[model samples]
Target: MFTKKILIDLDGVLNEYGKDKFNENYIPEIKIGAYEFIEKLSKQAELYLFTSRNLMLATKWLINNNLDKFFKDVTNTKLSSYLYIDDRCICFKGDYCNLFDEIEEFKPWYRK
Candidate 1:
């Protein structure tokens, strides 16, 4: 089975965007179960971080949250990656509700 490369967004997905941006110099607490969900995905596929957040902020967040090790690479606006995971994303498939279902059943998981 082939595993798809995953590109995850940091803000608004992994971490909440509720707090003041300036106050969030730190990792800003993660969303519920975000870390667990990513960790699960990381085991089966090549994980990459693709975010518009500043390098310093993004790096600090990853380090503090213990997520840096899960990612193969971290990319900002200057880079490109396949299969972006973001809060503000449009589904390629007509049925948006099945997005997670699709990802969960992607390869090895589906074969199982």
Candidate 2:
């Protein structure tokens, strides 16, 4: 059996980020349905917590929220994965020709 590797971001994907003022040691509430999402995904793929936040704090947050079991690791380095579920990302088509234009025109769905 083969499970697809997935890297899921923490801040805006799993956590209700920007809902409260930033705190280094505190992770805000989990996003609605985040647990359910992870639970369902965990059953189908390998999950990794890919974030720039502090690993210790993130681990504590996961433990507190009872979500520690779903993830294999918390990492800042990009690892091998089939998919990456992040709030702020653009899907690339391996064409560098339009990369600059794409970046220049990209907006994270918040401006609209």
Candidate 3:
């Protein structure tokens, strides 16, 4: 079996960005169940975290939450990756007409 490489985003996917009003702290507010979900996925395939945030900030957030171990690498805007996971993306498996169906069936945290 060929395991696919997955790249995940930080600001919205794993961490909630701008959650607190006008708060400029470097700290990241982690999404619910994000750490465990990433850890499980890491065991199945290659995992990469791609974020536009400052490297030091992103690194510190991951390290503080103990989620750093799950990622094979952490990238800022300077890197390239495959199969990016970001909230801003509209992803689907097949034809456009089937997009809604695919999304309805898609569950990143669980597989059958």
Query: For this target, which candidate reaches the highest lDDT against the unseen true structure?
Result: 2
Poorly placed runs, candidate 1 (over 4 Å): 1-3, 19-27, 77-82, 92-112
Per-prediction tally of clashes: 0, 0, 0
- lDDT of each candidate versus the true structure: 0.72, 0.87, 0.74
Cα lDDT tens digits, model 3, 53-90, are: 67777788888889989887788653444577876556
Q: 11-44 in candidate 1: lDDT tens per residue?
A: 6778765454545455567777988998999998
TM-score of each: 0.67, 0.85, 0.68
Between candidates 1 and 2, which one is better according to TM-score? 2
Model 2 TM-score? Answer: 0.85
Clashing pairs in 1: none
Q: Which lDDT tens digits does candidate 2 get at residues 6-96?
A: 9999987898787677788788899889999999999999999998999988888889888999998888889989999987888889878
Q: List the pairs of residues colliding in candidate 2.
A: none
Candidate numbers, best lDDT first, in rank order = 2, 3, 1
- Superposed by TM-score, candidate 3 places the C-alpha of residue 77 at a distance from the truth, in angstroms, of 4.8
Model 2, position 57: C-alpha lDDT score? 88
